[model samples]
Target: MSDKLTKQSIEETFRELSNWGRWGEEDEVGTLNNVRPEDIVAAAGLIRRGKVFGLGVPLDQPLQSVPHKRWNTIHTFMQDGADVATGMFEGRLQYADDAINLPTHSSTHWDALAHVFNDGRMYNGHDARRFGSKGFPVNGIEKMANRMVGRGVLLDVARFKGVDSLEDEYAITNAELDACAAAQGVEIRAGDFVLIRTGYQERFWSRGDWAGHTTGMAPGLHFESCYWLKEKDVAAVAADNYAVEARPAEGEGFSYPWHGVVIPAMGLTMGEMFYLRELAADCAQDGVYEFFFCAPPLNLPGGSGSPINPQAIK
Candidate 1:
C-alpha cells in the first residue's frame, strides 16, 4: 500500500487493474471513493494528448407520442423575393419566424437531481429552497458538472448479445454488466462515467413512432445494481436506455425503482439516450478502455432535466 494513494493514484491503479482482468466482487466499489482529483486531472491530460470525440445525437422532431393539441408549427417570413426597381434585389430573410412544436416531453437528456427524490431532500442535502422558485437545488445539473471529466468505460451489452439491438424489455442485471465489462477487458471505477449501449440510438428515426419503438431499460435497475453504483461512487451513469433501471420494479409494482434508489437516496445522476456507438467503436479500435469524458448540462433554472451534448476524448 502506498502512502500517496490519493484518489487519482487509485484511479490509475484501477485503470491498470481493468486491463489485467481485475474487477468486480473484490472491493471494486470502495476503490471509486478513493479516486483523487489529481488522478482525474492526469487522466484528462491523457485525453488531451489524443483526439477528442463528441458523442451526442442532434435533437429532432418527435416520431411517436400522444401529441398535444397546442403543439404545432407555423413559419413566417420577414422578406420574400422583394424586387427593387433598379437593383432588383430578390432574397428572403427568415428569423424566429418558425414556431415548431418542440418536444419537451420526450427528451433524450440527463436528469438533474431535482428530477427525482426519495423522501423530500436532494443531493448535497439541499431542500426545496436551493430550488427556490425554480424547483429543487439538488436537482440542479450544476453539481454534476464537477464529476463529468474523469474516465469513461463503455460496456457494449448489445454487441455481446450478438444483436443489433436488445429486446425492448430487456433488463440488465449487475452480473450482466460485470460480464460485459469483463468481455470488453475493462473495469468499472468510482467517478468513472459508465456508458451502456443498447443499440437503441440506431433506431432513433426508423419509423418515426417514438412510443413502442424506443427501447428503455427493462423496468428500472435492480436495487442491488443501484446499491452497487452508489457504493462505487461513480460520478454518473450513462445509458442508451430511457431510465438506467427497469421500466417498473419487479415485485414492488412501481414504474421506477432505480430512480427512487439512486436519485433521492443516493444522490446519483442518470444519463439517458447517450450516443454510445461511436464511443464504443473508438474504444475497441484503440483497445483503450479508459478515456477522458466531459458532459455539462445546460444551467436551466427550474429544469428537471436538460439535453446534454457529451463527449469522450481518448
Candidate 2:
C-alpha cells in the first residue's frame, strides 16, 4: 500500500470494484439485489427467543457535534393542548398534530446510493449533477424501502479485542473482520447486512462526549476492506460510528476514500450511528451473532438518505 494514494490508484480501484452493470443499467437498489426472497425467509427462522433490539438513538437529542453544522431533529407541534384550549379548531373533534424537521443523517440512518460519488458519477454511472436542491433524481432513498430486510451478521470487534471501544483512527482490516467472525462462530454470508460494533457509541453514551463521537477522530473500516465486502457479497455494511470508514483517512491525497469505492463504485448502501450496545450484550450472552435484521427507510422520493430505527430480532 502506498503511503500517499495517488488519484490514479483511486480511479483504478473504482473501475475494478464497480458494480455498475451487475444488476442492470438503471438499477437503483444497488447491492441490495443480492438479498433474495429465500434469504428473508431464512432470516426469519433465526428469531427463536423473540427478543427485539431497537438500533436507533433518540432523534430529539441535540447533535451539535455533527459535521457541516447539521442540526438535530426538531419536533414542533402544529396543534397542541394550548391550541385546543384556545379553541383554534371549529369542529368538536380536535386533534393534536405535529411535524419533525431533521437532516436524515442526523440520527441512525441509511445512506442512499446517491449520497456519495466518485468523480462526476454516482451509483450505476448516474451523473452527480442530477442531484440538486430537489435531491437525487435517480437512486433515491425511496428505491431502497423494500430492499432492507434480510439476515444481519454482527461482528463485535470491540468485544473481540477486549476493549470498551476501539482507539481513535483504528481501522478494522479484512483480516480483523475474519478473525472476529471466527471467534464469534458466525458466518458472513451473501445478502447479509453486516454490522460492525466498535463500541464507539457506547463510549459516547458513557462519557457524554458527543463531539468525540461525531467530529473527532474515530475508528472504522479500512479502505482495503472494500474488496473484502465485495467478495462477501453482503447487502450492506453498518457501524456505530459517524462515517463507516475510519477518520483521518488512510490515504494522503484522499478523504473518505472508502466511501468513494463502496457507495458510488460498488453501489453498496451503508448505515451509520447505530446504537448496538444492548444487541452486542445479547449476542455475547447467547453466542449467537446472527439475527433477523429489518430496517426500511421512509419512502421519500429523491431523498439522499432516511432516518431508520433498525430492528434486530433474536
RMSD of each: 10.6, 1.8
Question: What is the C-alpha local distance difference test score of each model?
Answer: 0.58, 0.89
**TM-scores, in order shown?**
0.70, 0.95
Superposed Cα deviation of residue 218, candidate 2 (Å): 0.2
Candidate 2 residues lying further than 4 Å off, grouped into runs, are 87-93, 250-253
lDDT of 2 by residue, 1-314 (tens): 22656778788898999999999898998899999999999999999999999999888755457556667788999889998899988989889999998988888999999888777789998889856898887999999988899999999999999999998889899999999999999999999999999988787788776764567788888888999999999999999988988886755446778888899999999999998999999999989999999999999999989999999999
- Given candidate 1, what's the lDDT at residue 291? 82
lDDT of 2 at 286: 88
What RMSD does model 2 have?
1.8
Write down the lDDT that model 2 would get: 0.89
Residue 233, candidate 2: how far off, in angstroms? 0.3
Candidate 1 residue lDDT tens string, 81-131: 332323344364332223333332244567776776434544434455444
